[model samples]
Target: MQVFKEKTLLKAAVKAAKSNAKIIGLVPTMGALHQGHLSLVKQALQECDQVIISIFVNPTQFDNPADLEKYPRTLEEDIRLLKQADPELWIFTPTAKELYGENISAEQFNFDGLEQVMEGKHRNGHFDGVGTIVKRLFEVITPHKAFFGEKDFQQLQIVRKLIDKTGLPVEIVGCPILREENGLARSSRNERLNTFEREEASFIYKTLLKVNELFGTKSAEYIQNWVEGQFKNHQVLKLEYFEIANTQTLEKINRKRKGNTYRAFIAAYVGEVRLIDNIALNNEE
Candidate 1:
């Protein structure tokens, strides 16, 4: 696999690949390669002639400085894992100064209220941080297609809005959410979770499944109260928020309208390690 820590060398390589009429696929990440991340790379490999993986832990995205500090940065191990996946992969491991500048910060962008809910409310400037890096990556790589996992459903949606707003000539491909055998959503943060915490975390997904089953038959308000009570009684997990909302605009809806789609979203704190999960209440559009 060819890895580029400098954008100049990376651009020359990408330009060379482009000259050959190769279709480029981009998978942006923040190091810490997991099975779920490999799945994105694998999908890109299947569809495009070449794939680029960007690994940089963005600071502006983190409202809490401690969270950013605690974020994983196992570059050597990450490279090892990616080598196992594909020895021919292209990885862009840029420094904040190299990618942004000495003064690194997230820009302000309105994602048409897509950033005003869920993760946005909990983590301020998160989407703007996302947009800042994503815009830079899209500009730098200029790939034909970009891949993202649905685990960060809100982030995925905001990214869609971002591309639409910026009119960037790239396709945003949303991949299915990967989960553990115990039903916990696969996450980079999963590495920090303790054994007991990981087991307890399964309840988060089980509760989301239960919420999916309870939808329609149970009123939205009733389901909301039920989730609140479920986490309230739990020994380890604490419910941050649960909402059944319209899938389109992400606005909280009391009643599901006919011909409209909805999903059940849950965010909870498992001690210090926070987890978020969502499930489709009905067939997807």
Candidate 2:
């Protein structure tokens, strides 16, 4: 696989792919590769002629300095896994200087309602950093399609809005969340958990499933309380927020109403590691 560290070289490579009338696919990641990330790469390979996976641990996305410092960086292992996935996939591993240079100004673009709650509220300016870097990558690659995992369901929603509002030509493809056999969502943060904490973390997905099961009969208020109770009972978990909101706008709903589909989303600290997951409720399907 070809690896380019400079933006100019990467752009040139993408241009050549476009010249040959090849469809381009992009999987933007913050390194520390996992099964979930590889799942996106696999899906990209199926739908596009060439897949480009960009590995840069974005600094702007972290609200806590310590969390940023603790974040995993397993580049050599990540590259080996990608090479195993496909020898032909282009791997763009750029330094922060290569992408951002000297300009460290705050991002100007803002997501309306989507950014105001859950992960956004707890991790201030997190999605702004996400939007800033994603916008930059979309410009550099200009791929026909970009792949993102549903494990980051809220981020996926914000990215979709980013494409819609900016009129970026690339389609934002949301791939399914790949989970462990225990049902815990796969995450780089999962590495930080000790053995007992890892076992406790699976309850987050179980709670989400319980909320989904209670959707139609229970009011949003009751469901929210029940989910909170589950987290409280789990000694190792610290609840950030448990919400039921409109899947499209992400506006929190207080009551269950007819014709409105909602998503049960939660973010919590399991030991020192933060994890987020969601399940869709009351869809026509």
Q: Largest TM-score belongs to which candidate?
A: 1
* lDDT score of residue 154 within candidate 1: 84
- TM-score of each prediction: 0.97, 0.97
lDDT of 1: 0.89
Q: Give the true-structure RMSD of model 2.
A: 1.4
Q: Candidate 2 on 4-55: residue-level lDDT in tens?
A: 8999999998999999999999999999999999999999999999999999
Worst 10 residues of 2 by lDDT: 103-112
Q: What is the lDDT, from 0 to 100, of the residue 152 in candidate 1?
A: 86
In candidate 1, where is summed lDDT lowest over 10 consecutive residues?
276-285
Task: Tell me the deviation in Å of residue 118 in model 2.
Answer: 1.1
lDDT agreement with native, every candidate? 0.89, 0.89
Clashes of 1: 1
Clash pairs detected, candidate 2: none
Error of 1 at 209 (Å): 0.7
